[model samples]
Target: MIGKARGQEGREGAAGVLPAHGMTHYPAAFYHMTHLFYQSGPPLYAGNICTGRSGTAIISLMGETQGRVLLVTSGKELLMEMTPSMSGRGMELVCVPTLKYAADRLAAGDCPTLVVDFGWLPPSERGALLELHKQFPKTQLFTLESVASMAPAVPSPLRRLSWPLPMGFADQVRVIAKPVIILADQVLFSTGAVQNAFQQAGVQAESLEFGAELPDFIRRQSEARAASARTQKPKKGWSLLGGDEEPEQEAAAAIGNLVVAQFTGSAAQAGALDAAVRAVAPEAVCYLVSGVDTQRYAMQSLKEGQPVALPREQAGRIAGIMAESAEGGETRLKQRERERILLLDNFKPALTALSQALIGHGYEVTSSMDGAEALRLTTKGSFHLAVVGTAITMAELSGAELAQKMRERDPDMRIIFMVDQYPLKAALQGVSQVVELGLDDAILKPVEASRLIFSVEKALERRFLLLENARLLKETQEQKNQLELVNGFQKKFFATVAHDVKSPLTAILGYAEVLTGKLKAMPSEGRYAANIQTSAKTLNVLISDLVDLAAMESGKLRVEIGTLNLLAVMNDVYERVKIAATNRKLNMTLEVPPVLPPLAGDDARVGQVVQNLCTNAIQYTKEGGKITIKAELKPDRVEVSVIDTGIGISKEDLPRVWERFFQTKEAMGMRKAGFGLGLKIAREIVQRHGGEMGIESELGVGSRFFFHIPLNGPPPTEGAAGAAPAAAPKPAPPSGLPPAPRPPQQPQPPPQNPHLPPQPPQRK
Candidate 1:
């Protein structure tokens, strides 16, 4: 019974014992019991319990975790001291002495946590640490310092932990559960502590200690996976088309497990390892561990952040935190999905680095190393924004010059400039230049990825706003054009209706006049006939005004130019309106120079203009008021005025007298028979004859309405002679009025060809 109890105690000890530094120094009895457990018992490690030594049925216990922690330090003594504490808490420690080795490890897969001992890192490598997060964004970075030199006022991404780790401080380390293949020096694997720890954590472990053998091993694995995939038969119904021949297949290489390697001191050998892994098994996860002497290096600089410390006792808690963080973690900077960016630079290294940084942040980036090539790309492709390097040296175009050319192609394209710090004059001018060139922003040299991203987002937002505004403006213009088109169509419809009504109206007026003559013997019947004739004539005048207004609106009013006798036109107008004036109890007179200069004008249209002015004067003048029609010859034109003692227009209403359908309150109360289009139509006719009309009036006294006819007549296009002038028809006398006698005139000259220009007046 005593021996059996002792055996049970040994088994329990082996099962619960933590793997740590100097773990090889166990009692002989403990080793014997461990051997026994390994040979014939339930698998002690987390690796394949069913497949045993073959490790074929490997299952990852930590597959839920996405990435691992990378420890970078050159302090061998510190590492040796921390190894035991880390191992005691079941944490996995992989240290790389240099930044290059750290990069290799991170590039292999995702890294959620990074711990760097800044105090022990070489001075030459300190600056590179500032940009480490850009290259590996998934990492949650921390730095160890010997002194608190950085100000707490400035915020930084790095979590700073003081050196000479505190007694109770702790840090989290990621656990690897998948099968691991280690490539390192033979001394590292000699003790088998790493293998044992991995096995305990359910991670299958193997080793190839020589760096020279990695390429061959990778090549063999790739060939074996390819052969296995190719040998497999296709499943039934794999091809959409039924055929005897096999369908084309893509041979997918199998990535079996993770790899942990320690590279040699030679950089070339390390580069070879990276190339071999990428070429043969691109999907394989790898960790490159390197070592250096901390005694030779010194810390020369510090970075900004809040100071913290990790304690040994709380190591287990830190591990749990790391596991939680890695499960589903986000980077410090937010990702911008699917926004295309054009990056221009002449320096290859800077261009490549920035390109990677932007790509990691979820931006679709197109980079150009030459300015000319960048311009070509910009012309061919559409981009939301462009980041230009102002100090370009490789191509014919500088950064600003290239941006200007791009702006010419796309006026609304958003641009940001990356300017150098040297040349103080240029740097100082950058702000004004940004505003002048309409650039979005200008960032100094060595711009941080975060700041650049913020600027880019702002620029893109502005671009979106501008595009939206332009779209709205275009829509408004389209609506305005549509409204104008509708108005034009309505005017054309009015003209057509007015023209159609004139033919029927003329017949009504002619029949009414005849009826009046026939019913002269009966007083009552004659009165009715006269009323019908008067109403028809008023309707005819309104229709004529409507037609003229529509024609003027549509730019179709016609005036046939000819040599005019001013005396004949004035006499015609006087004869037509004098009887109406006498009936209204207003005295009308006409005064003109008998031998006035021959004017180039349309005789009938000019007669109509004079007649309209006289009619308005007669209608608006009070009883016993005087109306005088006067004509005077000026140096370049003839002035015709109608002076009346009438209810005149107010100053406020004078300017609006020529507007169609506009009427004053006094005019509406005095007469509701007209549509207020007469003055507007008359003014248009006078203008078409190369003339202008205006009115001078006072509210209570009198009004003088006048117009000017240029001696040259209307422009050639407006008043070109199309046909001979039609003779003016005589009006029937009104009821109970004598016939208007014609004024005697001198013998008229022979008519000239209608198409010929007006001849000079003959001096008699």
Candidate 2:
């Protein structure tokens, strides 16, 4: 059974057995026990254990110690087995089972060391350890893992140690041949452990408690080494003919090879150190030896493939990693240097400065102060990307126009625009236009080297992505087939629905007419029946139009040509639409030459076209508007026009009126009842008769729609009319008769008897 010590008596008894070490003061029992567990291994003592008010077993030792150390693990037995070995050594061990408890212990006070057992931790919970370390960087951190063999040779900071420590642990943790510098607290350096560790690892190590002097020290060392190397160079051998002169040696690199830094809980200090290292050695491999937390110095380490933070225990791997990184960094630099960039700016100073900055970053840069010269350069040599100023001064081609021409030359090249900040709205609009035009990106000037580099990288990345997508789409034949199938199915579905509704709609119209007649004596009921009949007729026309649209889309629309009597077709249409016009209080008229030449066309379709025009005019026209259907004889054909005093179409909208499903804004506002397919269908019919259709209109001023059909009928090539054309030559209009004059006003025609069948109008 484990014994417990509590209160002052327990604290006194535990303190009596502790040995003194010249370090920070801490509770005696914990200080002794932690050292015993770390140094002597396993359970050696258990009698000094004490329980706190919170029910956790804490061993309190009062003595001078290095600092308090927190051990977090899930293995309760390990703590129980090791509790008895708490007598000497200046360290404290507080064991907790989870990270939450570890955080709680940390919140209590200053703890300078923490050890985590990874065997019991989950991968998902590993990030919490980094957070804990970030919160408490003063802690000397370590980890114990059971599966160290499975870790990568160049392990990340979180996976630095293994349980059942690997062979030659001290040797494995050595820094090999590279020099190491340790920046830590003064007390840490005084302990001698950090220095001894580096010494035994066979590396020259220096310690600096203050971070400010590191950069100057490095710079001085570099200068001295450079001076020494220069002095050591052999003098060129002389011959009378200069044949024995030695080849000049290659210059030493300006950047250092590798640097390892230990962060002492100061972000500004760490950043300064990083900047200094970069100034002296841009390609140097920097290793940040952080505790369990790495978030502290993340921002300070900006360059890719430069600094990777590692656990303090992995200091030995730095030298090996440095050699590998150096080789890999050179390869990457070469690849970057191969990327050719074209810079175009009419402003000479800006162009020169930007060119130099890009070239310094290892890009091959070609710059031009004139837009035309820049274009010529692009033709002469290939470039991976172009950086252009939006305002190109003293040039015939603007930046935007130049970009378009360049794209025409090579579609794959990536482009980025540099825009000025003045004229704020225009700059914003320019940025938007860059995206709209599918150019890569836009950067607001004055451009910083860092920002420009970042933009260039991202644009190139997008270019590659688009190219890959285009290649994939080309190879996906199955997707194309599926798209075509979907379109075909949609057309078929619309046609099927239209056909199914036609039968029911015919019955509805017939029934409504019957109801109207039966309920005539009842005025209200008769009105309802009439309304139903009217609605049914509108629906029938819409359905017929939909059916015709489907047929035309599928290329199945056909015209059965026969002898067409212009007078009879016009009169039939006039009678059919006269009731609708009268209901709306609109005046309608039809005028045709008294003697007209016989034409070859489909009579029913022709009447349908004329009726569609009359219906549209009625729908848009205000009350008491006028509509005229006029036909005149021409030398080769007859011209028929539908003139309306309804709302007129704007000139811009007139061209689009013939397009299917397109409605003018005014037309839609006045009547929301159409699919806008009537005009499209009517025009298609006219074209199928080997004729052309056109419209003239003015907003709010009425419109005139017309078509011309040959008198000899459609040409022989137009699939021969059902009958021969009448042998009569074209007849002239009545002498001294004005064309399309309105008749004198007279009494309104009486409504047709509801029970009487309607009769077709006779030809003039």
Highest lDDT among the candidates is held by which one? Answer: 2
lDDT of 1 by residue, 53-100 (tens): 111111112123233445665544444444333433334445555566
Give the distance in Å from residue 576's predicted Cα in candidate 1 to where it truly belongs.
Answer: 3.0
Q: Tell me each candidate's RMSD, in Å, in order.
A: 27.8, 22.0
CA lDDT, every prediction? Answer: 0.59, 0.61
Model 2 residue 747 CA deviation (Å) reads: 41
Measured on C-alpha atoms, candidate 2 has an lDDT of 0.61
Q: Can you list the residue pairs that collide in candidate 1?
A: 46-202, 47-202, 168-311, 169-310, 169-311, 170-310, 170-311, 172-318
Measured by TM-score, the strongest candidate is 2
lDDT of 2 by residue, 1-764 (tens): 32233334224334323322222333323322222223346543323343222223344444554345565655555454433332233334466556776676666665554566665666557557866866875544555445342232222222322111235543534533222234433222333334444455563455554556667767765775576567555555465546555433433332232223334544345545655664664432223333222221222221231133334344333233333333464454333335678888766666666665665555556667678777776752388799988887436766777887887787888889998888998689769869776788898988877888899889878877887899888768778888889878968976998999999999999999999999999999999999999899889888998898888887667677877877788888888888989999999988876656666788888888888888888898899899998988765668899999989999788779988889988988988477889999998777666566778888998988888776545544333433332244232222222333323434332223222455455555
